[model samples]
Target: MIRKTSLIAVGVVAALGISLWGGSAMAQGDSYTIKFGNVISAGDTQNQGYALFADLVKERSDGRIKVQVYPDSQLGGEREMIEATQFGDIEMTAPSVGVLANFDKSLEVFDFPFIFEDAETAYKVLDSELGDEMLAGLQNSGLIALGWGENGFRNLAMVKGTVKTPDEMKGIKLRTMQVPMHIAYWRSIGAAPTPMPFPEVFTSLQQGVVDGVENPYELLYSAKFTEPAHYLTETRHIYDPEVILISKDFFEGLSAEDQKIIQGAADEMVAKIRSLKATISDEIRAKIVAAGGTVTDLTDAERQQWIDSAIPFYKENASKVDTEKLKAILEAAGNTTYLEAIQ
Candidate 1:
């Protein structure tokens, strides 16, 4: 009778152990670590926003999901990180729409110069049904688009002097991203566009390898390009909006609750980024002048001329990518002149 009781007791304990182990294993399976990579520098508005996203995800998930952020190209350049995200090598990345245009040619519409006259107009198009369709289209490319983040506007920072008009841009060896449209636009305006990596920009400016570089004021000042290329123009030529992306495969594998947590956190992150960017350009513009850099604003006529200069580019490249999407964006932005011209 003792032996029988001992065997029954052992069976009860074994069953309890099995139940406890199964519960623990299920909990472990629910937890996930997400790796997010970007080229934005640490402590920049974008990274600060990303940090908030990580915190929110962790809090919302009750510590079941953790986001590990790698900024300043710690993972790699924007293009490299994007490919990594697509392949599930990294879970997330935010890349400028220009670089990402290479992946989804439909995005090339945003890369066109002088497309958005102001941030408000850009936001209207981006938050519209049109934008949702574009974001949804990324699933075909193995990416889950979270939302649009700001890169502000692109302005010319020249070593020689302020370039207030397209005529002034003539023959200037300007540093450009290796993006074909940007290069083509610069060339059409008579500037010799020198395509090179971001790391080499400062040295190129200092050594006279390139006469100037173009980026937003924040990037120009933060990279110290303003020190070398002191002439800053408010070209506002390109309203760069970065897209936050996640790996489609990895995202699909997550629990539906976890997916909701990520999407909620990402929406908040994008809002934070846009809010920070609203005043960042003015703040950075002041800083550039304080450090003895020249900031030039285009007059009414000059701004008009700049807009007209892009007419030729629009005529040449409109049909090359997504013409319908391009037409839609131009029409939505109240650029009827460009819309008519392209048609």
Candidate 2:
């Protein structure tokens, strides 16, 4: 009788233990939603990569995590969205390194004009230990950076005439992002740099609020900035890289498994964006010309002239920011001339 009672007690305890374990598992299966905002248009390659990230996260999480993307400055411009992300009002944002440098001064290295000659060289610096350190440093600012995303090289799009040589940039009222380094560089070349928000760029161009704007070909074409700014120049002055950022509080609160899912998805998303960007500049250049826009290619001499224009700006400002980080990027990019000049 005693033996039978002990067996019965053990069976009841085992059944209750299983029931409690099942309940705990159910409790762990909570769902989360992410709001991702950017200035990229809906069908652009950046948005395409963002959409892929959303899909990958949801599928991998078995629909436990959902990401809603707001593009075309729907959630406001890059600065506003970055603020939103920091405050945890929004979950994510991808802002250009120039704009982001406003929050973290270490990122100002990329703001220097012509630091990178091509995307491959830029990628070499960005994917290195130095880049990871920079991204990791964002945690102190209440944000977590996933990885670097591309904005490609910035070129000139003018309202009337094409600017090939530095001399031609004189007195040209140009629109630039609210980045001090950019404004300083353009001003050094004698251009009047007007800092404005991205949303106002089109109307600013149309109403002559600004004489011209600079960006990658895809952005100029997709945003229809080329409609008013008909003269396109392959200045390729700045290699812009955007950071994939999430709210530190929001990210830290997620389960470890969920965090892994998000990080993996972001990695893939960046890769997709880069792959799409490889031939996009050329493809969009053709589209712009077909749409009755004038595209200009600088001669080798003209290009050398443009490269040389940044030297004075570098000599003046190199010691102002993180000189070692700047040196690392310049050295990695094979811009030995710039590295030596800054020294």
Candidate 3:
């Protein structure tokens, strides 16, 4: 009788252990939602690129996690969404690094005018150890930096006229990304650059609030800025990186496995987004011309003039922010550029 009773107790304990184990597993597999927002249209490159991340996360987690994309400022502007993500109101957001500098001043290094001579050079810089270090800096500021994406190179599109020289931009009221570096560059070149959110730019331009706007050709065309600012100048000035960011609060709550999935997907999406951006510029410029936009390709001399003009900007801003780090980034660019890379 004692032997039989002991066996029964063991069976009961085993069943209880299985039930508890199943319950813990189920709790971990419980469904969750991530709100992903951005400041671009649904079909734009950045949005399409972000879809890769969302898809990967869901696939890797087998639907335990879902990311709902809110494009066209359905949530809010870049800065607003970033703050929301910081506070855990939103799960993820991608914004031009230009605007992100406001949250972490260290990012301002990317804002230096005429910094990247070409997309290839920009790519090298972004994929380097220094770039990785810079991306990691966001964690200290309450955000998780997933990987680098593209904003492409910024160009000038104006309502008043085509800008072949900095003198042409003088006294022209222009709209700029709510990025301090962009505003400072425009101001240095003698244009009245107003900082505004992406959503407000279209209406603001229509109302004559600003005479011109600056962005990559893909953006200027897709955002339909080419509709109002019909003249597109191929300045290729600042090649800005876009950042895939998530709320540290939300990220902390996630299982380590999910975190790995999210970041891995982001890495893949970065490559996809940048590749698409590389080929889209020419195609989009054609679309702009077809849509009654006047396109101006700058001469080598004119481009050099723009480069030389930025020296003053570099001098003034480097000391104002993280000068040592900024100098390190600039040195990396100078040393690793294709010309120097070949030499």
lDDT of 1: 0.84
**Which candidate has the highest TM-score of all?**
2
lDDT of 2 by residue, 1-343 (tens): 0123323543454434322211332123578689999999899999999999999999999999999999999999999999999987899999999999999999998899988878998888889877787776677787878889999999999997877899998999999999999999999999999999999999999999999999989998899999999999998999999999988666655555666788899999999999999999989999999999989998999999998898988999999899999998888789987899988
Candidate 3, residues 266-295: lDDT per residue as tens digits? 888888898888799889988988888899
Clash pairs, model 2 backbone: none
lDDT of each: 0.84, 0.87, 0.79
What are the TM-scores, per candidate, against the unseen true structure? 0.90, 0.92, 0.88
Rank all candidate structures by their TM-score, best first, as comma-separated numbers: 2, 1, 3
Model 1, 250-310: lDDT tens digits are 6655544566688889999989998999999889888888888889898999998899999
Count of backbone clashes, every candidate in sequence: 0, 0, 0
Evaluate residue 48 in candidate 2 and report its C-alpha lDDT on the 0 to 100 scale: 96
Between candidates 1 and 2, which one is better according to lDDT? 2
